[model samples]
Target chain A: MNAANSGSDMPAWLVIERVVRSHWSLSARGERDAGAVLLALWADDRRDLGEGFLLRAAYLGASRLRVIELALDEAAPAFPSLVEIYPGAVRMECAVRDVLGVQADSADSRAWLRHAGWPVDYLPLRHDADRSARFAAQAEDYAFVRVEGDGVHEIAVGPVHAGTIEPGHFRFSVVGEKVLRLEQRLGYVHKGIEQRFSQMDLQQGQRLAARVSGDTAVAYSWAYCMALEQLCGTRVPARAQQLRAVLLERERIANHLGDLGALGNDAGFGFGLTQFSLLKERLLRANAEVYGARYPMDGIVPGGVATNLSSQQIERLREQGMVLEAAVVELRAIYDEHAGVQDRFVTTGRMSPELAQRLGVVGLAARASGSPRDLRSDLALAPYAGLGVQAAGSAQGDVAARVAVRFDEVIESLRLCDLLLQDLAGGAIHAELGAAAAQQLGIGLVEGWRGPVMIALEATVDGRIRRCHPHDPSWQNWPALEHAIIGNIVPDFPLINKSFNLSYSGQDL
Target chain B: MLDILKRIARTGIVSEPQLKLADLLSERDTLHAEIAGILGRALAIRQVDAGSCNGCELEINALNNPIYNIEGAGIRFVASPRHADLLLVTGPVAKNMEIALKRTYDATPEPKYVVAVGDCGCTGGIFGESYASCGRVSNVIPVDAEVSGCPPAPTAILRGILSALASPRR
Candidate 1:
């Protein structure tokens, strides 16, 4: 679709035009923003990677005809801080500063990178670090949002948690059971992933993307491969595309199963946990049997899938899927009918539809908040478009609504998986992706288990990746967590947080 | 009684021992083997997330599910300076997770072995390091054995653990 006429569905494009008023080459581009068209441009190179491009939208309130030069340099690019214009861009700009070495020349350039357990001298995204240099051990005082009141206390939870979960420090300023302010201190699990990419080949890099978050393997892998393919101008075989859809659907269902169970368990319903856990186990086992991996990683390569599913495997998948569906239906009825569970989840952690829209929360959480922005449908790509998939959403913006959205998505994914299997095409699984042409930039967007994952790939001469920026939905949604838990009780944080299970690692990257 | 029976029916059956002696004997043997496995060798495991997208962590938590029972294997994830005999970390360690990767390695107690479970942990199985990633676990952390597949079936993770325990580096 053409950029001007593409309506909300138009692909994001970067267009350079010369302003008649100024000699500078004005760079203007369109990005999909909450079902609307938003333009972002900047005049500096050093701030480009960190501020202009990194921050979703930075509005400069100067002359309308001011010439803007689009900066796409590997080392550094400059962009004006929109924190003054659009306060929402603050966290995003800070994130860019942490990973990418591009420092935001904004007013608030405090000790963002040196917080928690991150090494100070090293910037993970920069390519200058030596491979053998031992990461220096440094500990700096972490600054958290302070709150003072009568009978109010603060609880500092660990970067090393009680469970086997990743390290993230949660500081809650609370009065008895009511939480006044909750500030998150993450980066404890920060590994120099982006920096290490310079030292590895494309294949190795793809592995890292998939592991960004373990659950959303298909989404991250596909997003990475899509970026790679776009850079090299490779066409994935139709069969491979279909297989990818199947893998993605499988991942969606598996995650839903686990989430459903966990949500239930969180509300003191052990039966739901046991039943859903059992269902999840069966599904994972089937996944392992068919895809050789339970979570289905390495399934999507640059040009196509690394492996193919056989007829027998497909049949087995169908059978297991059917059984799981039946169990889900049965278990869901039990959950829906349970009064105590329903009461706990119904309106416990409510993020009003209006607030959700303003914050731009995506995935199931967004859907629950009445934002119907599904990349699969709204930004339809490949097999999903062909299949005529319908995106599901809710407007309640509550924990129960989130749970319901997940359930609806699980059912929809099951249907999609069945259709994909039935219409499985026979063809070569892969196409040879030749080296990327120099200075080629490609954008990849895929709906992950959590939400839409956006990846931008820039290649250098000889096909080496110059810069890659994979934006997880969590980047936008993590802040929403801070907002969602505002009025809720301190104990309900887990329930609310679980509803929108944003990945700290995914966001940090 | 009828209500209880009906509720039981809704869930599933409650299994009773068919042969108490045989059950006792099997349980004893299983316990004996588990203890023996723990005593036989000190296992060093390094977790590499080939690419898991963390759904596996839920199940990994369930490994200590108090039922399927992981600790009974005498397996524990260690975090400190050279105390970990096994390195059990997760993730396709994203680009940001790279330094943590080296630190995890540096902290491992000597003669440490690595077991990369989950697909992402193995070969950067899925989320190959994109612009946001360093790619695979092996890229940052030195790996000994790879438990391939996206979050290798917990059974696979178990098998990988067993294999790591069996093979000790001199």
Candidate 2:
């Protein structure tokens, strides 16, 4: 195995071979400290493609960021645990232990999360496990982070909440009204998405990705398609790329609008919710009229988009845009004038740039805190690159900053969508994706509405997916919630949480 | 106050006042029908999430949208085995959700009606079963009606619910 030294002196890409054996090759790329590691396992046979496993490890070294990749042999071998090396690996390791049934030789193996929810013997991701089985087994209790202090009362909230939202448990340790510490207990929304992917083909898989988080359908589907296209070596049509961008931006605008309203409502501004909801309703209706789906699922496919827009539709979009723009301008003025709304949002739930960096927060939360790391702008993918993407960010690192970032993003998205509509080119909506050639691995990074959505697709020679990992920005930002809630009054938790609006299903997946 | 005025000025001038009035009347009519339908029969709904991320639930809750109402449909999501007549579930049931799948099914009071809304819920439209799923709602649950599209438009969802109610229970 090739090992690279940590520090600024290190090269952008470190190629590691025979890390475990001849069967696996690991490539650690990007800057030495702030880089990602890609591990590709050589498939000796087509069956091995279905059987092989790829594991990703992300951590921050003393000076730089460290990411390691491990590819397991079909005959799973005992590998040394990286949990000792990077404490973050503990969660990932436990995940692997539960899903892949890989026995990790670690001291912290006190049922990390593998509650007896499933039959003790059945690993859902594995091929042989019979799905239709009896459910007499009881779920094992998850180990929550422990907290202790005088007057530090522990408040446990929801696997089931009062609102019509997904299930998640929040454990708050507060000294009277001030929050001392906040520990989130997720996985209530864990529906075994990764395991389900094994049962689907490329066409079916795209649909699944879109549903990974309903709101992020456009991002998840695009990321999934990117991975599939890479594996299949298919080039999407330029028009299709433009269409995808339009849909993605629409999704972004819709969500941000809704969030802005929801955050306002959470902070005791119902008028904001009403106005935003009306705007959102209008936007969603426009989407349905144009894309045939309000949320725009199945619109993005592997090679290209599933549908096309006509001149008439484009004209309708422009008309709708005029309406939305006016509404946004109106709302912006209201939000600006509302000192009461400003008071709650300005300094509450502040996360410093240093703290954001340490927690590895991505998307708007990170950007608001002065981390100008936008995948659309920095990565410069096709349609985004053409738009001359200008990222708007702030160092306030507070709820106001996050809201500002979202507002800016909404405006930027509207501009991009209009540009895309204006630059509508005539071409085929989609291309036929052929079978895979060799055992190949492909990575997909899309700027989802929430933030950067990363999807890694691995396939066998016969075009079957080996392992697909769709990483939502929520994974990185969820932890930041715990920190943001600190020092704030317990009542402000809802508003702070709403400002970020991280996904339970996204992170649990 | 200036901002409010600006908002009024900025609001879109869609010639929908007449359409809005018509829709309002129609919505009221639908509400009456829905209430009558609910009162006439205990409508059991099976919620099938073909494959949504669950945003539709927000709007679904809006069935109680306060204004564009649904309780008049006498619609209720039953949680217990005996009380549930309609199974209103969501998502293209993820692989992990399969067990919860059976539990949800077993928990539902039989002679239940199923309404699969959203494309994923209907046919595993987008999120076909992949490494993370079990495919469509029908794959696990016995779906009676399929509401198509990524997320069936809310109107589409209402239509599906109405249609499911129209159908005979098995």
Q: Candidate 2's C-alpha lDDT?
A: 0.66
Cα lDDT of model 1 by residue, B38-145, tens digit: 556433333433223455575575553333444444555543435556666566665434554566567666666676766567665444544334556677667667
Model 2, stretches more than 4 Å misplaced? A1-32, A35-54, A57-68, A72-90, A103-114, A127-134, B5-52, B58-88, B92-149, B159-170
Top lDDT: which candidate number? 2
Candidate 2 lDDT, A239-333, residue by residue in tens: 99999999998989988988888888887887787678777877877877887766677789888998899899999998888778877776877
Rounded to one decimal, what is candidate 2's iRMSD?
Answer: 5.3
| Model 1 clash tally, residue pairs | 79
Interface RMSD of 1: 6.3
TM-scores for every predicted model:
0.78, 0.80
Q: Name the best candidate (by DockQ).
A: 2
